[model samples]
Target chain A: MSTGATGRIEITDLGIEFSRNGRTVEAVRAFTLMTTPGEIVALLGPSGCGKTTVLNAVAGFVAPTAGQVAVDGEAVAAPGADRGVVFQQHSLFPWKTVLGNVEFGLKMRGVGKAARTAQARTYLSLVGLIGFEHAYPGELSGGMQQRVGIARVLVNRPRVMLMDEPFGALDAQTRLTMQELLLSVWREVRTTILFVTHDIDEALFLADRVAVMTARPGQIRDLVAVKLARPRAATVIATPEFMALKARILTQVREESVRALSGRRP
Target chain B: MAPAPDGGWQRPVRRVLSIGFFFVVWHYSTKWDVDLYVRFQNIPTPWEVLEEAAAQLRGAAFYGHILASLERIWLGFAVATVLGIALGLLIGWFRLAEDTLFPPIELLRPIPAVAWVPLSIMLWPTERSSIVFITTLGAFFPIVLNTVHGVEGIDRQLVRAATSLGAGSAAIFREVVIPGALPSIVTGLSVGMGVSWICLISAEMISGQFGVGYFTWVAYGIVKYSQVVVGMLTIGVLGMLSSALIRLVGWRCMPWLPRRVKDGG
Candidate 1:
């Protein structure tokens, strides 16, 4: 399969704020990042640290209050097919069959029935959901539904895939399996991915570079490159290098987590 | 544990027994010379009603009355469904439409369809149209309101997902909004069907020349109490069958709903 060239993402000093109950709350601030085409960049932060907000901005769901986000030098304005987003939960259209959900984007783009169905079937098989094509989202397990969500976006062949804790609601075993599945799929598709997650291991396992974010007024605090060998297995978590990296990132994450819990903004 | 061997037969048996109990009570209560119950003295026994129903069912004129009532219901319900769904979708999806269209509807909704009898009679040139108009009014509100609630209650993320997937407004409405609101819409249709029957019967009784409702009224006017009961039972059975038909269509449309819910569990 010939995978097309995916676009690069550039986030320059991005900031987002929301006004709630007559109070302006800064969700993200001076959050600068860059992702080369096909790079898996994970934004790792404590809960409510606004890391998802950054992904939302990149997805063009939210406008930055400061700075800018661009894909392939094109300014972000509104959500488009070039950028596909997989939400944490309830992403798939429940009313649609698994095949229908996968074909949704192509259908929206006016792709013909025969072409879209063939393409949808390809992605469905890629996600290991071939026999379950007629099943509705409600009938599937959470992991299966999320896989459908992934297939739905991957069929679009987006330049950038924005995932907001896509496996957050899964069990530990399912999460690990999903992470592995994501890695294998990413290797094939090689689309630029900005994955947001609270799990340190998940961030370390899936991303080329894990960008640790601070709490409240979230900003990128550290960018740690994972230099583990290619085709890294789940056993990599037991390796010395992986352990050292996890320990280092844990300390920084713990401090930000404490600050977040105490209602301190920095 | 597995179900009992007789489980399949149990429900039907119980249902027949339940219905038999009602007839038994009616027979004993309205027995001739049973002065113990003065209130039941004037009413016909179940046997007398059954005999009258058999005689009526044999007559060609009885079928005409049934067909007339059915025709009026079909026309009014069809009109209500089209208008209700269109207006509901518009009001539910668009803020401007909601603001402008909803207030008047809400104001008129509280007024019973029966109350519209005088206005309907004057507005339409024929009695049939007037009766249909009243029936339409009865079915309209439930369908419209439920559809509005269904649309409003749709998950925002579904809309966002469709948008991100390159869906325009029309595509989103067609794929996401319609299917998402369907369960509620089906509920509305069912309720609308029931209410339409109520309004249809009332309108027919008041002004209809040939209908089951009119037949019942004529029987009562002539003190033929057994035929009146027969007409009432026919209406009840017809209303039930129509409601079940609506539910059957709902089940077919929403294959995504669980089997239990689809089967009316």
Candidate 2:
């Protein structure tokens, strides 16, 4: 059930390099991926595989040294409201109440106070945080804070939502609950999502297509499409088809992680 | 944090008893004319100081001195607060402002307030203005430095998040930078309040016709030793009250801080 027809993220021959202490370090090389108008794609790989670097390029946080990222036929040169990003943790403004944080985007866009408040309340309720309107970020649990982060981004209604391991910091039980919550939210909002994560189950459970990348100087090694049915539950993970896909992906991830460790030696 | 002293009236009673024990020791020390490596023989007894304080409390002139010192401190502190926070925000958030403004500040920050006394007296037309100038200079550095530290210490990810949320540069500064730096700014204000008093008293003692500092200096000159003790006590009490006022305002502004954090402050 696609709700938006505008979020078509296109990355072409993207490469990113960082210079540190007079040394040139290539983070992502020839890493290219594209998404259809309401697709959820997970960039899955081992830690330091530059999966996050790829996502950052799409979010316009880091400039690509070699190619370009375009959203809906327009080149992305800087961060904009059209693309919203949810960081892993501590992204919410500590000084702001939950309601204020959610309304920040509308406030920045110069929306009048009453309209923004109404819209913010709507999204906060969507994330099941109606009673915590005036609570500060520091007072919430990790999972609750991430929910606020999601609502904050969704309220902006960006063409694409970029999440960098948003649930990675939560406990395992909380992460599972959040994944389910996110799937339900996605079913309604239907904006394109580019999720970055290292967890195999998480990548398979939440994404329509998982783009697996090789370790450092990361490149897409495989693009596996999840043929699993919609409205997936945790029970679906124990099924044979899910198990088979998990086995294949687990092998690839282990190989890449080994290679990544060995390559660190002098 | 020290188990919160078990949360009872015992804490307050113990505090009173602790101060009372100190008074008892001081009274006996002067009464017995204790003279070891340290000398309490010439010191005023606690009884004599209490008598002087009672006498001073009844006089209108004592209230005038208190009012004069408080006015100087308030004026200097208010001006320093405005300038320090404004300049600090600009300096901390903008590279150009930092480069252009910080070098001169760095050069001047090392000069102590007492060192500026003679020059400030010469620079300003009035004794009052010069003393205020010293007080302002004393308070400004801590506030501005702490504010800059606060701004620079903000997480880079927060700015990125704000930008992605459609915030322009001005909006990021207002929404993220200002609020992020607020806890530290409050810390700066509290520190600046303390430094303001120290500078005000030093300036007043050096050259002033009124104020507690001047009253204390004149008491020593006239050999009103008990009055000198009373003035010193007044300065201590007033400084404590001013700090409490700052802590109160700090709590009011940052309601987001948890109660534990509020207590730690």
Candidate 3:
């Protein structure tokens, strides 16, 4: 069984397609990535570059037309509790209180009420929403709602966390703060996280390695490793290393976006 | 003060005032002092109707008629709610059932609750059961339709989120589907309850041996203007009270739901 310091995920040559009005659209084309345990990898690309499709395939929401997605030596044939996902829209159930949303996973696992509440409370605290456990999701601000989304995934302690532009909806300032918050949480848990984003600075700030993808027919263009020091903060965005990484990623994104707009294949 | 966007309480107050104004206009119009076929004695004033209603309240017959009508409405309304919510959840969730059953229900929905009265009377042995059946038919469609729509309209992400978190099918339905669709379900029930009252009054009028409808019909036959007015007021007050009760139930169950414009004000 795969375990301990190295949280491994191996995806080989994945392809996904969407059927629209009897026409087949190629959404993902021959994507591939491999990372050892405890590594945070960002799938970075432009808006139309099919970055989210790859993450969905990994999370088991979408099936790849070809190839495989394996996490910690096990084939991801279906969505399991092992791979937690945070959606871009902050999909906290509006009817449920914050604690109920956090406790949902434990309940699904058939954990006792006592045990689940204890687990949920710990997770709520991790996301800095300890006092607001009984509050419903609708009462929260956008940033706070996203924090609930984050805490929900973290509590499950999955082998891999598949996040689809988790901080995309936040303002620039809040985004930076959330990025730092995520870094601190990731530092403690050391979970292998597959984070998806179109933001260049975000890709550099949070991920250990950034996997750049091409247009519609997305595939790994480059795997640039970001070896910045631990415990990253908002200030990390201003550093020379961060800017250098951001510049490289922006070039890749601009090329991909141009390719998409031209109505040409990459 | 530039009151809140919707002077929150004013709409209800306005609705009540409008209804009162209409009655006042109706009462003044009924004063056939100029030229009318029916005399002022036939079309009584609002004050005359209120006086008759107050006088009738002293009698047990009026209360008895009210109780009978209330009993049938509560019964049929209750039956429809239980069946509608359950069947709605099933039809809403399963595509095959939705396709098969929904078409027939949609076709039948346009048929008035009163239209079902003759068929129900022919089918049922007892008057009470027929009344209940017609009322159920009346209330059933709105509640079922709304519940299904509510369930269908649930945020897809919420279902995906709960399922991804490892919730089983049962938990998904209970914690996610039901609560998520609650706003819609309650809407259906409130409408169903209102419809039930409409059907109950009609049904009572058609086959009532001892209800408000029977009393009103008999009064009209004998040209008892005061009794007719009394019966009409009883039905109106009872209908309004029942609807208010249903709305109160909706409020207590779903404080999270947005409050809409109230009726009659």
lDDT of 2 by residue, B1-265 (tens): 6665566888888899999999999999999999898998778998899999999998899999999999999999999999999999999999999999999999999998878999998999998899889999999999999999999999999999999999999899889999899888988998999999999998999988999999999999998888999999899999999989988888998989887777666
Query: Per-candidate TM vs. native?
Result: 0.96, 0.98, 0.93
Tell me, by TM-score, which candidate is best: 2
Which candidate has the top score in DockQ?
2
lDDT of 3 by residue, A1-266 (tens): 24455458888989999998998889888888998888899998878778888888887888889999888788887776788889987599877789888888888888999999999998888878999988877788888899899889878888888889989998988888888888888878888899999888888888889999888888888999999887786788799988888888888889888988886544
lDDT of 3: 0.84
CAPRI band for model 2:
high
lDDT of 1 by residue, A36-94 (tens): 88889999999999998998898888999999999988999998878999999997998
Indicate the fraction of true inter-chain contacts that candidate 2 also forms.
0.87
- In order of TM-score, best first, we have 2, 1, 3
lDDT tens digits by residue: candidate 1, B39-84 = 7877999889889989998899999999999999999999999999
- Which pairs in model 2 have colliding backbones? none
Per lDDT, what order, best first?
Answer: 2, 1, 3
Q: What TM-score would you give candidate 1 relative to the actual structure? A: 0.96
lDDT tens digits, residue span A90-149, model 2: 999998999999999999888999999999999998899999999999999999999999
Off by over 4 Å in 2: A1-4, B5-10
